[model samples]
Target: MAKVQVTSADKTKINTYTFFLVSRMDAGKKYYVVSELEHLTLEADSSKVSRDGQFVGKLVPESGYELPQNITIEYGSDVQKVSGNLYSSVTGEINLKASWHMLIRAKGVKASDFFVADHVKYQITSSENVAVVGTDVEDNATWTVTDCIIPATVSKDGKNYQVTELGEEAFIGCKKLKSITLPAGLTTIGERCFAGCVSTLTEMHCLNPVPAAFPQLFFHDTMEELNNSSPVYDCVLYVPAGSKAQYAQAEGWKNFGGILEDGEIIEPVVGETTDSTMTITCNAFEQATGYIVKVYEDAAKTRLKDEYQFDADGKLRSSSFSFTIKGLSAGQTYYIETMAVREGYYPTPIIISQNTIEAKTTGTATANEGVTADKPIVCVQDGEVVVRSSGEISVRIYDLSGQSIVAGKVTGYGSFQLTKGMYIVVAGDESYKVVIR
Candidate 1:
């Protein structure tokens, strides 16, 4: 698809009888003709046959058909083709028919109307700009991801579109998304864009320095599922550092929890590694818009292995959801760290040599710290809070309203009874969810 700007001046300045070539090609060599513009209206002409036996209307129209040059049919028995304009030929007194394809000002189509870039759909805003329409569920690689970032520009077919706005219900029903970051250049957000991502979302990052306008029911169903006291519940909104005050007064953003600046929220754990390649994962840093991985030549972190950190575009090297460091000597012990990346936030520098956390697998009701071990200092066992240790270990349980139900210091073993419900069991600096049913 092609995006062109047209104005009153274009009516006289541009080619009038010229054929507008707006074509698209896919990997399988299937071709399509789709064109959309701001001030221009493209109407294709597909009537007569060409000189070298090629049919007219060489390209298929967005809302019409492509017909071969000549076709013989019963004159008035089964003619079903109808268009804005029709033409027929008479061959030996037998009526011959041909179909024509033309697309006028496209106000009826949406998906095939424009183009997609970087697995996100875009609606043409102008000759030079496009707005995010929605996530491409069929082509998107981040559907199960918890954190997704919408960039300022996306490239497709050797062209780039400035993403300035987000259409209504853009991310609706994206259930796996726990957080998403909007680019700084974005000026508008539509209604229910974040719907269906309810209690799972712990944070949202809006990089726009100025608050974007929205409808009154923009977060209608979304806020109803969150724990916000007013317009938002337990969801935290992270805005730019200096723009927090402006967002505090903005209608669409003011009522969320903790409108704060960016901070460190990554917990990196090393995963499958080879001589030159490795994967670094984190335990759900909800505030992270992106991630950055750096490799070091020395364990002390003095010399950086910059070759492995960025790509040709100067962007951080990353795979889908993790960092994979390549091009290393097979047996060398190089150090690496993956930090939670955002627009204006920098996490504390991590030393791979000092990292002790292992690869994590998040679950619905487990809040474990450190390596998994069977030592029952505190655990849930069949509707009872169990605590056992060689020395005295503090054990406590709380209800939903932070009401302490069990408070005790125990040695060897101790058990507290509870009915069928949910409780937060705490032991030292670690806490785990125990549900009795």
Candidate 2:
């Protein structure tokens, strides 16, 4: 068994804690599973201050070893009423300023300290021991490596520890992860470390030149979409310069569709466009803090006409990305270019051809506030159209044949009963289509 050490940081940050659980599953062989214990605490002016010490319930033990579930916690002196998870509680979704934190414990196993970075969890077994990168506490769309640390390290109680390896099933069932950047000091990648990331993962970077040896089925599939449906999968591996041949010969590392030197930048995909706006979205570059969308008047891309910036903590937003460039002339053809800007990486230029819609000369004045296309606070209930906003709103209903079914003004909350099929409800400038069943 691997020797484990407990540090004071382990208990202090238990609300956002990370630790390892030694799960003994029937056989004498022992397995280790990383546990990220989450709990919410009330805050006074942004600092966490504790209340009473009432035990809620022990974290679902490692014997079950399931995905972490939310534990309810209360604030102030209201122990009778509790809020749900950290996100919901903090955001007032649960109508409370208090949130729950994680509680993790094992009956007979040694506990160790852990920390988190870039949404990835790391358990510290020894301050000087081999660094082991743990799995993510929650699923994410995209993830980036920590700030270019050779041995990803964390400081707690005035001491620093290195994160040097990937734990077992570190990224299993991360269906939305589209891109990743591996650390430099990593020496071992456990089995199924990148499994079930089939939906959108298309590229990754390995900073280590002669680094970790990957275990069997490092990128295997556990999700149904990849296991029984799609057979085609492609991923590009970018390694350090002059080490492409070394990685090509390494087991499991050669499975990528292509390997390249780490400095090349790829183009982003172009999405929807409007008369005055065009949406360009892309995966985050290895260490980029944000992306710059540059619009050009010509295909040469040398002349920059307009630019927009999107910042997302150095990772792609939602494993997908999108940002609109507004103020372009309508009915005009424009060239689009994207540059993923990073601290230490070269910004590569990506180009796309785009055409704006014809400018609207005269129509109902559109309101950009309150409502949005495809999502509106209006809904039909009790045979009436319920406007959810507190302000006055003008609404128009159109049928499939472009015939007007109803038009009216609603204030505070108003409703109109209408038989349903497929109808487009126009509120302000936003139009919502509904199929009444």
Angstrom error at residue 49, model 1: 46
Q: Judged by lDDT, which candidate is best?
A: 1
* Model 1 accuracy (lDDT, Cα): 0.49
Global lDDT of each model? 0.49, 0.48
Give the distance in Å from residue 182's predicted Cα in candidate 1 to where it truly belongs.
0.5
List, in order, the clash count of every candidate structure: 5, 11
Q: Give the per-residue lDDT digits (tens) of candidate 1, residues 1-437.
A: 22222223342123222222344331122212222322323333334322222223321223332221122222224433212113111110111122122221212233333566555667666766777766766422246667778888876567787889886656656677777788998987766566555445657888888888855545444444434424543456777657877987887677664465543223344445554455655433333344456677666778776532322122322322445555655444555555543332113321111122222222222232222122333444555766554355678889878999988786656888898666787865567665554
lDDT of 2 by residue, 228-294 (tens): 5422235567787678889777766665545666543333433454556655555444434466666
Listed in order, each prediction's TM-score against the native is 0.37, 0.36
Stretch of 10 with least lDDT, candidate 2? 352-361
